[model samples]
Target: MFVYLWVLFGLFALHEDIVLRQHGIRFVFHGFALVNALVLAKVMLVAEDLKLGHRFQARPLIYQIVLEAFILATLFIAVHILEHTIGGLIAGETLAASVPSIGGGGMQGLFCVALILFVALIPFFGFRHISRELGPGRIKAMLFGRRESAAQAKPPV
Candidate 1:
């Protein structure tokens, strides 16, 4: 699961790199891509362990969706901020200057990243909830048409 999540982050990072390059920006993926992917994966693992959305299943589906989205988005945004802060330090700049360096995008970049992450995470996590109840092995079979042996499956919820 972490590998899959990291792959998605890599793709997203590539998209950002392409867009940034088109704008004549100095930003490139380099080592930052791997760092962001690993950090995002860790954030996701912690989020899953907390099960914030699953705790509120009695609410409307939209409510749960929003909660999960908010949590995931916040986690990702926090990591982005930290990454920027670290970059600022390495560049001998103030943390304030570095944190919002997305072309001085400031809060705008944070909001955009949060919204994009929210939308991206919905399918990953929404169906994950259903998959838990239905069994991971069953969901895998449903998705990939391959029978998963019990040993290869997650314990049912």
Candidate 2:
């Protein structure tokens, strides 16, 4: 989760840089991205322990994977809102003013952000489900173990 969030937030930082550069503002917030990733990673761990999206466990693996991703994405959106609101409150802003514009700044922006997050989470959940099914450490060995030689690959008569 940390790696995934770091990559996602890193891209956001890059995008922010490009947009700010266009407006003659010099800003770099990769550090903030790293911190955000760490916070979100912790949140993810907690959410997983709580089984935030276990409702689809009896359904297909894809269903669980997608549902979990959506759930986690929604949680991330909520966390972002809460974090910004708290920061605003700390800065002496009113509750109404403390609510930051999510996504780009409006409903559509929020939707876009949620969609991106959900999509990004898909691979993580997919791999996690696969790993679980494969048993602990099995996927790692399958992925990293040496391939069988041609002679060893042959089946016995």
Candidate 3:
């Protein structure tokens, strides 16, 4: 949850730098703005499954991965479009003028965003599957690689 936000934030803010900061957008601490851009990502993707396919039905791993990736990428882009549209409306721009912004510098930029998101989602879903298998504590240790202090583990006398 928070980890996904952090990861996506890092990926977009650090890697996409100038692209993300376009249109007078300022880069802030810890990529909070980037995270905010995808705020619906956590809600729409994580809190509820996209249900692109059946869980009980057996399917190839690649099949599932592609499906999840496509759905996520589509919804992610849609959210961006909505944001841009609203911003445009607020600025008194017509829908025609606003709609083009969602294309994100044209198809190339849109593809780039989707590509970055697809790459980010790989680990997003990967860690989730791994977490289910190993449990969160182990996953935390694997990621952050830190153990509790001995003093924090012992019972008081």
Candidate 4:
């Protein structure tokens, strides 16, 4: 599962690199998608581990999952729209009718929801378990004038 998520991210990064190289633009919209996907995956995995959800059930848990999925979907679409608009602007090409239409209906909406859920669930179910099993460790840092031990200033005689 981790490999699959990384694969998806790698593919996006590759695609963005191609666009950057060919178009000579400093920005690639897919880069934003890649970052969002990482965060979304992490959040979903944590939520799932909380056992805050039940599959195919009409419980609050399920609803929360669905809502999170919805949020992911919106973010995905926003990434696409921003990418297309910017790409088009850079190339001096008018966006086609099929490109990033604001009022997409039915199938597109469903597809976005499904994509978001699938991506979100990957991290939610996988990482959450690992994170919980390996609890966050306390890391202490002594900086500035702080010292780990007071006993020893051996003179450099």
Candidate 5:
């Protein structure tokens, strides 16, 4: 699960930079890293808060939940890139021809499929978590920030 998360993170990073073009967003990397880190940190803090272990400060649920949505949005952008890239490569015979064959069914096909699944699942869980706890408005605010700027900078959705 940890390994998969890391892979998803890398794909998310690539997708954000290459596909989503979210360069205007501040602390993109920090936002991405904090989501998973804070979740685990929160669990530890909550455990410690109950005197289950050593001292650790629990972040407010609101903060953690907000960051999760931002991370999910970033991950969604990245997954969009990965999906189209794979689709293009597989659909184009000349492009697929360039992929070096391994043995049997070939590693490239398996690799591309695995990437798509990994990218797709991260956002699904992230969205469910955010929606269940924080509400869409909270998530939207975190992703796009305050209403004034969000309205001013709205991307053509």
Candidate 6:
């Protein structure tokens, strides 16, 4: 999860850099991405420990994965809003002014962000579910094990 969040946040930082560079603003926030990744990763662990989205566990894996992703995305959006609001308040802005526009600006932007986060979380949850079903270390071994030689490889039908 840390690695996933780091890569995602890093890409966002790069996007921000490119967008800001167009306006002659040299802004690089890779450190912010790193910090954000760490914080979010920790939060995710806590959320998991608390079983934030385990209601659909008895159902299909897809249902559980999607439900968990949606829940986590919503939690992340709330965290982002709270962070911005607190920052603004610290800067002496009024309560109303402190609540910055999430995503890009409006409701559509917020939904877009949530959607992106939800999509991003699917793979993480999918892997976790698969790993749990497969038992410990199975996935790691399967992923990193040596490939079969051409002679041993099965031919395409």
The best candidate in terms of lDDT? 2
Task: Write the residue-wise lDDT of candidate 6 on 20-125 in tens digits.
Answer: 9999999686898888898889889999999988988888888988999998999888887898899999999998998878677898998989998999899999
Q: After superposition, how far is residue 55 of candidate 2 from its true place, in Å?
A: 1.8
Model 6 stretches with alpha carbons more than 4 Å out: 22-24, 150-157
Tell me the whole-model lDDT of each prediction, alpha carbons only: 0.75, 0.91, 0.66, 0.54, 0.49, 0.89
lDDT of 4 at 141: 24
Clashing pairs in 5: 15-78
How do all models score by TM-score?
0.72, 0.89, 0.63, 0.37, 0.26, 0.88
- Tell me which residue pairs clash in candidate 3: none
TM-score of 3: 0.63
Off by over 4 Å in 2: 22-24, 149-157
What value of lDDT does candidate 3 attain over all alpha carbons?
0.66
lDDT by residue for model 5 (22-125), tens: 55644346355445544433543453365431122265444444444344444433444455567668787455553434212456644564455544555644
TM-score of model 5 vs. true structure: 0.26
Stretches of model 4 off by over 4 angstroms after superposition: 1-5, 10-59, 97-157
lDDT of 4 by residue, 54-145 (tens): 45345534454455455545554655567678778777777673355543456776575557445655454444343434564311222234
lDDT tens string, model 1, 68-115? 878888877777778779978899997677875442477786577778
Q: Write the per-residue lDDT of candidate 2 for residues 1-157, one digit (tens) a residue.
A: 8988899899988998999999999977689879999999999999989988898888889999999999999999999899999999999999999998887688999999999899999999999999998899988888898889888897878
Ranking by lDDT: 2, 6, 1, 3, 4, 5
Error of 4 at 151 (Å): 47
